[model samples]
Target: MSAKLTFLGHSGFLIDDGATTLAIDPFLTGNPKATMSAEEVRCQFIALTHGHADHMGDALAIARRNDANVIAAFEICNYFEEKGHGNVNPGNPGGRIDTEFGWVALTQAFHSSSFEGRYMGMPCGVVAHIGDKTIYHLGDTTIFRDLELIGEIYRPDLVLVPIGDRFTMGPELATRAAEMIGAPRAVPIHYDTWAPIEQDPAQFAPQGVEVEVMQPGDTLQLD
Candidate 1:
């Protein structure tokens, strides 16, 4: 099977690349748009972009239930281990970890990383190469000049970005990010979860790029 991406509300996503099933930032339990419960979600690997409650929500619970490996920054990994989840891949920015399916590279993300009164390290994004396709998930971040470099390095086929302002990039900046990333297709995320970060996807559809405005449970097939 080709790489399939499903938006799981907020910053959460389920990615199936035939060999391995991966979930990212599982904030579904409390999210209104979430389709699956923490128990209903299945994945071989659970990747976190940061240590915020919203981003790391339901991660330990879901990973424990499914016996999945949790991937995140070193500081966040320590927190997971303290919670008795030993299967953690503590990675740093610019590092790549090998998984059963492919390689996942930790990239820089302009966001804070703290959760549950605990302070983790810096936040990060992910560049995953599965089969012939490369996917970029920009976990709660702002638009940066290095995005152009990331685009040149990974040349991702699909990019999952945040269009929710207040905390992350809004529609206007996110549109510029799409161009900077130069991905074939881009999907908006982390919007409409709360009043502070509400945004409309249509306002961020960049010209010449395939913009997919997916709802909570919508799934997209990646080439």
Candidate 2:
């Protein structure tokens, strides 16, 4: 009854708390490692950290077909609504939205926010609380000092981070990020999508942090 976390490749994740199903960043359709297509994905809620195409991939299509609520930044939410999906809950950094399972807090993430040439400002990460477990997904960002502040505030059980270079923090910075966030367990994502961002998880795994290198369609149970 705690929560189950599933990695859907390249910043995509599916979370189920037994009561509610939530998908984060449905970048599955075009991803080589992705297991489910846009039409095949099922969820009650979809959480987006930014407006980038890769992160927002197939979200609209999936949300529309599944009739799921989409959670994202204000501008991104409006954009999705304009696209004809009105079930969007606009959130900002430091804001919280109540879901069927529990509350999901919008946290700060240092990244650009734009989708299809449109400037959708205010990208953010999500701190979701379901049952007794709290999870933090860092979105696409670099290593920042305020991560210690976020860790102090949420005290997450599991942390999902991007280890892809060129756009996000690679293994070196991700190692520092893991230390800053102070999460019990950390998983690396957003890598190997293309060249210039390829990385080996073994090189990133260090002491004191339970580093889980999850493949596409892999499931991790949090109890």
Candidate 3:
């Protein structure tokens, strides 16, 4: 089976495998680059990487409207539950949450997680398996050596890397990270949203890999 992966801008994505659809970090409400609104998103599941406003944007709204399951760190799930969304699948770094399509695993990320002065949980990178393809969304983080090991373990066909500076790895380091992961293909994310994180995608070139610079609403087919 093949999956259609749509880039929802600024680290957000929609992955659909025909039977099930997932929204990862669906931050569209305040996204200047987002072409679709929160109400336009349709998914059976919502998987979040952290609790930042941009990353967690419109998750609850979309989930509640669609009655979708929320997947994220344990604290994030608890947070949502407190907000009245009871259907959640919680996991933490080094843990995996099973889903109908496949599974969602959280990996360590060098970043912080919080929302409205509350400690959400450890920030994480998500590895999701849908159909026969695997996707690694490296949330928000600085370049780390473990990415190579992560690549070896999951061997994802595609990887989503953050190239924005100040908050995460810049273009130069992100290129190294993509090379380290050694995925056949990679997509640049979490950049060009704000002036602080502005970047040129052309600066991100990983050897032996195809770098796809996706714009808002761009979709890719993974088989």
Candidate 4:
């Protein structure tokens, strides 16, 4: 089955697999490059990588509007639940949860997780299997050695990585990471949205790798 992946600027994305649609890091309200609003997103599931505002922005609003389940770490889900947004699937790194569309596995990420000074949970890398395709979204983190292991385990067709410096891996590191993961295709995110992470994404060319730099609201279809 073919899947439609829409870039929502920054680290946000909309993944549609015909039967089920997932909104990941739907942080658009304050996003200057956001092409769509929170109310416009139609999805059955919302997957979060961590608790940072840039990644978790507008999650509650979109999930509440679509009545979608928010899948993330235990504390993150519990935080959403306390806010009165039900249907949160809480899981931790190394475990997989079968969903209505497919399955999601949480992997380890080297980062911090917190919202308003409240501990959200350990940061994570989300591995999603939808429409018979696997995608690895390495949430905001540095390039770690385990990515090679993650590649061996999931063998994702596409990998979404951060190319912003200071907060996450920059172009060179990201390029090396893509090679380590051995994904056939890669997309750059979490940069150029703010001054702290400003970057020229064109420099993110990975050696011997296909790196796709999608504009905000651009869609990539894979069969």
Superposed on all Cα atoms, the candidates' RMSDs to the truth, in angstroms, are 1.0, 1.0, 0.7, 0.8
TM-score for candidate 4, residues paired by index: 0.98
Give the winner by TM-score: 2 or 4. Answer: 4
Encode model 3's per-residue lDDT on 128-211: one tens digit a residue.
999779999999999999999999999999999999989999999999999999899999999999999999999999999998
TM-score of 3: 0.99
TM-score against truth, every candidate: 0.97, 0.97, 0.99, 0.98
Task: Give the winner by TM-score: 2 or 3.
Answer: 3
- By TM-score, the better pick of 3 and 4 is 3
Q: Number of clashes in model 1?
A: 0
Q: Write the per-residue lDDT of candidate 4 for residues 1-223, one digit (tens) a residue.
A: 8789999999999999988999899899889889998888899999999999989999998888888999999999999899999789999999999997889999999999999999999999999999889999999999999999999999999999999999999998998899999999999999999888999888788776788889998999988
* lDDT values, one for every candidate: 0.89, 0.89, 0.95, 0.92
Cα lDDT for residue 161, model 2?
84
What are the per-residue Cα lDDT tens digits for candidate 1 across 126-175? 88877667889999899999999999998999899999998899999999
Which sequence of candidate numbers ranks them by lDDT, best first? Answer: 3, 4, 1, 2
Q: In candidate 3, what residue range of length 10 has the lowest lDDT sum?
A: 91-100
Question: How much does candidate 1 score in TM-score?
Answer: 0.97
Q: Please give, for residues 1-223, the per-residue lDDT of candidate 2 as tens digits.
A: 6899988889999999887889998897778878877777888999999999899999999999988999999999999889999999998999999988888899999889998899987888888888668989999889999999999999999999889888988888988898888898999999997777889877676458899999988999999
